[model samples]
Target: MLCGVHNHDLAPNLSGHLLAGRLRGEEKQRVIDMTKSLAKHRNILTDLKEKNKESVTLI
Candidate 1:
């Protein structure tokens, strides 16, 4: 299950590169937007996890 989620998360990045030369203007822009959004969310998740770890350590 975790592996599946990891693969799903990577799919867009892989697709963007695989289809890079083939993608037209709007499609390429869409991929870039999706990647940016994913990165933003991933950063938020990482921050939350770090905070959780710190709290656990203090407990």
Candidate 2:
């Protein structure tokens, strides 16, 4: 579920990447653990960028 904030309240970075929304409850804990797990490993950053690039091209 989304946080449901008004669109006008949302802001993007200078590069136009929108803010990753705030997380709450048990879902937030899960994301925290998942992030730590990803960080402990290698190549996640590269893999995400590569996947995003491929997705952009496909779009």
Candidate 3:
């Protein structure tokens, strides 16, 4: 199931690379956008950890 979804998602990237010459324009932009979004999510998690530094206690 996961493999199918992953393959479906990868189809466009593979098509773009094979059909076209290189990963340019939207493809590159999409990679950059996804990277930035992931970074932002990581940052939010870090910030949340800092905010709860004194409150959070492990059992």
lDDT for each candidate structure: 0.45, 0.41, 0.46
TM-scores for all candidates: the values are: 0.30, 0.27, 0.28
Estimate, for each residue in 1-59, the C-alpha lDDT of model 3 and write its tens digit.
57546544444333324444344365446546756777565554445445444323121
Q: lDDT by residue for model 2 over 1-59, one digit each (tens)?
A: 24866656534442323333222355346546657776532344344435444321110
Best by lDDT: 3
Candidate 1 residue-wise lDDT at 46: 51
* Steric clash pairs (candidate 2): none
Each candidate's number of clashing pairs is 0, 0, 0
RMSD of 2: 10.3
Question: What is residue 44's positional error in candidate 1, in angstroms?
Answer: 20
* 50 Cα displacement, candidate 2 (Å): 23
- Order of models, best TM-score first: 1, 3, 2
Query: Residue 43, candidate 3: how far off, in angstroms?
Result: 18
